[model samples]
Target: MTAPASSRLGIYCMLGGMFLISINDMLIKSLSGGYSLHQLVLMRSLVGVFFTLFMLKMEGGFAVLRTGRPGLHLLRALLIVFANTSLYAAIVSMPLATATALYFASPLFVTLLSIPVLGERVGPRRFAAVGIGFAGVLTMMAPQLAGKGDIGWVMILPVMAAAGYACMAVLTRKLGATSRASALAIHLQVAFVIVSLGVWAVAGDGRFAEGTDNESVRFLLRAWVWPETGDLAAIAGLGVMSAVVGYLMTQAYRLSRASTVAPFEYVLLLYSLFWGWSIFGEWPEPTVFIGAAVIIAAGVYVFMREDRVKATRRT
Candidate 1:
């Protein structure tokens, strides 16, 4: 009885987390035109650390910060940084909707990677789904291949980002179970600090000096023109949303198994499409939608098949 109840709670958390993550994607797109991706990443990471820490304190105080699995935390953090950086780069370079559609390919990558890394069995039906998902990616990307003023190659950024995210997922499932969420969150920030600082140093060029010689650097460093008061509110809103989404997402995984939670991530692409159309006035091409549909269907089939297989094994 307790097991069933806990499982139900976990599923709820996972859905909540996905919803928050979708919202975060929307906020990032909302601010894209005004802010450089670099500045946005830095701001979000810096602000996010505060909220994560606060949640950690609430959960278990200082003890939550302790982790026996430093190496696993380090790997997860690095993977997260890579994913964030790549996704941000994609956001800056391509249409949000398109990039997100491509990013959805991450699950497919995860499916494939699991065979090699986790030794998970992939049946024929699941293999077909993986193939179809990649086909959808190709279908969506075909137009860009013609080089008709479409810099769609930038879509690959999100795909790579997704792969990094998938790696994080893999690590989380394999090693993070024993680690407290607070400890994991803290290590994530420490990793972010390292990555962000490294990016700032290599990309910085003394823009911090703020003088005539550094005017160009400042412009690059500054995400956008002095945002209006409303924009400021929006940026801060994104910060708050990040915290909320991250917390909910963390909670969701705590309640559920990774395989169970993984499939719902597909729903995020739908949200991305809705936001992209509403906010950016950009409707994806017909093929993009078709491709997305194929990918999503494939993912669903894979999930169902895997569950069936697991059930059979148990029986």
Candidate 2:
């Protein structure tokens, strides 16, 4: 395909993937009241694993899963498990847009980590952008800091989730040279299975006996209840959504320049906002809108700057 055509396809794939992901978050958040995080993860991972296996078979049978970098893939999976768990925790308590906006800091974290991890040098401009981006984070977090909001300490979960996601991104870049995207994707499902089962074994029974009123704690500690038919269908759909999201996002980056497609990811915030409002009657505060704008602007600037640097080096 022509570069322009390929880039357009990539952008569309990204938008589709982000939209599905936003929906997945909404579903997870909606189900948080009735399901333990471990139960949700375990159920979703089972479906994801089956879906991924089917995908792998269609792609090239089992050989496509072969990789020499199992250790790296394992670490990446662990990081993602952490990221997903924390994100779900945040989602249970915080408005979707607010949680998503805080998680938007992943790109900034990636930029900062690149210097030390990849030995990339950042110029002053991108450094300034990072500073401004962090300022935006603090702006969204101001209410929590002042002890005036409902979010409280749970707000930090998304930031921690973002950091974990950033680390996974860096590691994925390092492994991209040799690993199949399918392998990487399935490894995450495997990790989710392992982690979820571990959590269920250790805490599920005890927590079920004594449930707390706090949503976040209940989300974490609640035992597996048999989901209602609708909830079951939704949770099952989550697996399918995750598979589609993985395919689209992977194809998106594969089909175009990362810098070209990265900016479009900010659309996730808008999708989150819409879902938050429509489903939960929750809207972000004005301060959140301002903070999100700053974060998105900074992230886009970083991507643009990186593109410029690459262009300059090529010249």
- The pairs that clash in candidate 2 are none
Q: Estimated TM-score per prediction?
A: 0.82, 0.95
Each candidate structure's count of clashing pairs:
2, 0
lDDT of predicted model 1: 0.71
Clashing residue pairs in candidate 1, if any? 35-223, 36-223
TM-score of 1: 0.82
Tell me the deviation in Å of residue 153 in model 2: 0.8
* lDDT measured at residue 83 in model 2 versus the true structure, 0 to 100: 95
Error of 2 at 105 (Å): 0.2
Per-residue lDDT, model 1, residue 60, is 84
Q: For model 1, how does the per-residue alpha-carbon lDDT over 1-315 read when each residue is reduced to its tens digit?
A: 255666677777767766667667777766765565555666676777888888778778878667777777787888988897778666645556677778888777777878876888988888888899889888887787766546646656777887899898777767755776677776776677667667566655434534533222333354233456776666666667767776777666667765666677677777777777787776767777888888778777777787788888899
